[model samples]
Target: MTNINDNHVDDHSNIISRIGKCIKQWFIQDFDQNSGELDAAFKNNMLVVATLIVAVTFQTGINPPGGAWQDTKVEPGGHEAGKAILASLHLPYNLFLILNTLAFSMSTQIILMLVYNKKLYFEVVVATVSMVATYGMAVWSLSPDKDVKLRYVFMAALFPYVWRLSFQTFKTFFINYPTK
Candidate 1:
């Protein structure tokens, strides 16, 4: 019985160690550009998916959940015209804005990555900036609270860059560092 219990313990430890390695490998997996697998068709498919994401996110930004305020009001708990009705709820509205902005940012990044032509790339970048600005304005006009809205928009927009920086830092210090 004692020997059987020891084997069970060893099996559990081995399973846990394997799971840990798999999780680490998943995070550290790199996109091998020269692997001869990422061809033009794959790039085109990715671009189409990214473009769809951009469109969906843009639509949501313009027409947020809970709709918009129609008339101006001065009383407490009352909102101005053109503001979002969901703004009053605070938490859900903030989550919705942040997630939507993050989706928009990531989709735009994918589009930028896939475009090879210089002129087209430049045009996409300009359009991306314009879309971001329009989204910001839509959020601004819709949200009643000034401080929180700006924070959410900027944080969500920069999250992809921040995420990449963090991953690079981890890969450098932990994954690529001398293991000996």
Candidate 2:
């Protein structure tokens, strides 16, 4: 009877060890099977390219009156028309504009990290792009004359470049001092 009890205790100990191992694998492992599944689902490069294209098309085709090269006034009727369009799409144009800028910037950074197989510093990129985009939007939103509007329009055109620069800066920092 004593020998039988010892065998039962050993079996229980083995089961507990197995469970502990599973838990560690699930939570502590850096690149496990589950992580591989997630990585496959969220292919960063595709997301970045698609989002960038959408942002560029939305900004260039809809947001501004025209390309940066031409000076144009936003007519009262045109503003009304734009508002109508936004209403039809169930979006506030200004809010959508901000979200689009953020999404594009984030996607660009993610793509750069994926391409280089490195981690990026998020705060710096976010701070720089937010500042630039906010200033650009302010100039665009507050302008009262066609020439001033033209300058804002050009500023808007520079958003993509600003985003790229932020990513480049982050990439440099990441390469120099990678986390972990």
Candidate 3:
């Protein structure tokens, strides 16, 4: 009984130590262990993630779910040409648009961050701006509802900025705030 109790305590201690080590490792920023340099692999992985997100969001924006209206109709209960059929659903469509835009914006931000220190940063910024513009155009053109179009465009264009600003404000106030 005594031996079993001792072994159990030792096992708990080992587990705790392992947990602590894992926490430390996770918190460590991506740096080459030997040279203390930023890991290229980390940057590459981030860039790939960002690019893929942009591509998916762009494709979804252009194609949308349920496709576009086949023909234009000015009558009541009819959809216009080049408008997303999903937009007619209201709530689900709005939710999808918001989430997709959020992903797109955050991914673009990541891309900017990764390339901010690069030599061709200006060119990359221009390309990202163009991509953003294209995405906005896609969203604006595909969404049919006149009332919803502005809202969708605004959300797609500005939600990421709002999100980043809100995040930074919260981080500054709550995270980096001095605790006396």
Candidate 4:
């Protein structure tokens, strides 16, 4: 019984040590000297806005060229439209785009977490914005009329701007630490 208890204590100690090491690696080591010019809130805001800009640019420049929107073959199904949009880009149908978008969102969260030394709370906000933007574009692409299509184009164009504005508002609210 004594030996078993000792082993259990040793295992617990090892687990604690490993957790400490991970925390140090993730949140503490090189943190003070490597802190960026902006605070956590500002960095998060900047990342969100920058990602939106990049996404908007890519979507507009690559998909539906020359204002010629493509219609979906399947009725009431936007998946075909989404696939067509992806096909028009001539890019591989791999997870690159999805991963890229996720990376952008995570990068913002990580930056904010590092800045504040705490977990970020705005990941849901970023994700919601992205989803809404994507859905809006998909719906517009599948629209049966030119006017609605044009309206979607305009909405897609403004998607990034909306995200930017939202990020700006977030920054204004929480970015109390000024840039050095």
Candidate 5:
């Protein structure tokens, strides 16, 4: 005689078995649709992106936003204002420093992920988005525009979809990945 507890346990086991079989079947059914080229493309694209971020980080530090460092605050002919390092650690320099560090860190993480054969697409997307934010800070420092709050609001608005897509992309990349 099966007790009620036994029936409950059996029901749970059945549900788990069904879910596992469905997952296995789905993978098996769709495995053939994925091609080797897709994996290679993801790898190649990651390499390109990592290299670009490193390059951009170096360039941003060397050239800077407003311009390269200048000894004088004003140009020789009183034309354009020179971009001297600020008197204190003010917005421009502080922002640049923060962004530069963040960009470097994110890019380095991406590189490490690639080198370690870690195919986590969410990490890559997040690092890319961080780089975007870093560049946005850099741009804010350079531009004389006055719409600070709007940019923050816009970035906040776009972040949810970015995160969701990052997770979705991570799953898809794994699914579409060519298995050896």
Candidate 6:
């Protein structure tokens, strides 16, 4: 009971499958060429990024752009302080606080993932987003001009997300090729 229509469908499916197989094979060969070196490189690279992210988050959260708040008030000559420093310009205090928290949280998670030996390829994505958000918060809070268009900053932020997705896709394509 062979339907002629089924043959056409199978033929099309076979072609698609072959194309996919070729792509998979290419990536595998590329990885094989490097043996386990790529995996080590990726891990090392991720470690570096995570470290930087943690540092950035820590610094931003602790010092912030405005500075830490001090209770001592100066009589028009001494500097006043609060939980955070006073900005020469308007400060998006609330926004920075939230972003700083998120960045720190994500950084902590990355460290946990490393310790647990678990990989969802989440390090780059979460870290990148956290870092970008922290940066945007800084730009938003510290910049004196509120009228400044943030389209460029927004676009720059998007790059990390895009790069993360692209990297994970490639890494997943190789899958368990190697890790040394």
Please name the candidate that would achieve the greatest TM-score relative to the true structure. Answer: 1
Runs of candidate 6 exceeding 4 Å displacement: 1-38, 71-82, 86-91, 117-180
lDDT of 1 by residue, 127-155 (tens): 88898889878877778764356686789
- Stretches of candidate 1 above 4 Å error? 1-25, 32-37, 116-119, 146-149, 169-180
Model 2, runs deviating above 4 Å: 1-58, 61-91, 117-180
Off by over 4 Å in 4: 1-21, 24-91, 94-97, 103-131, 134-136, 139-180
The lDDT of each candidate is 0.79, 0.48, 0.76, 0.47, 0.55, 0.56
lDDT of 5 by residue, 25-88 (tens): 4544421244323365676688789778777875675456556344433444322233323313
For model 4 the local lDDT of residue 95 reads 33
**Candidate with best lDDT:** 1
Badly placed stretches (over 4 Å) of model 5 are: 1-38, 72-89, 117-180
Instruction: Work out candidate 3's RMSD over C-alphas.
Output: 6.4
lDDT of 2 by residue, 1-180 (tens): 369889999999999988966754443332322345336556655656755664574453334433222233366533322222342232344444455445544555444444444345566457546744664554354333332224334544556568667655655555466433
Q: Give the alpha carbon lDDT tens digit for every residue of 1-180 in model 3.
A: 369889999999999988966654454333433338667888899899899998898789778899988888879877887889888887777777778887888889888878876899999999999988888888877876454646665666577677667655654554355332
- Against the true structure, candidate 4 reaches a TM-score of 0.30
TM-score quality measure for candidate 3: 0.69
Ranking by TM-score: 1, 3, 6, 5, 4, 2
Estimate the TM-score of every prediction. 0.74, 0.30, 0.69, 0.30, 0.36, 0.38
On residues 68-96, what C-alpha lDDT tens digit does candidate 6 reach at each position?
54565657534334434543333355455
Report clashes for each candidate as comma-separated counts: 0, 0, 0, 0, 0, 6
Candidate 1 vs 6: which has more lDDT: 1
lDDT value, candidate 1, whole model: 0.79
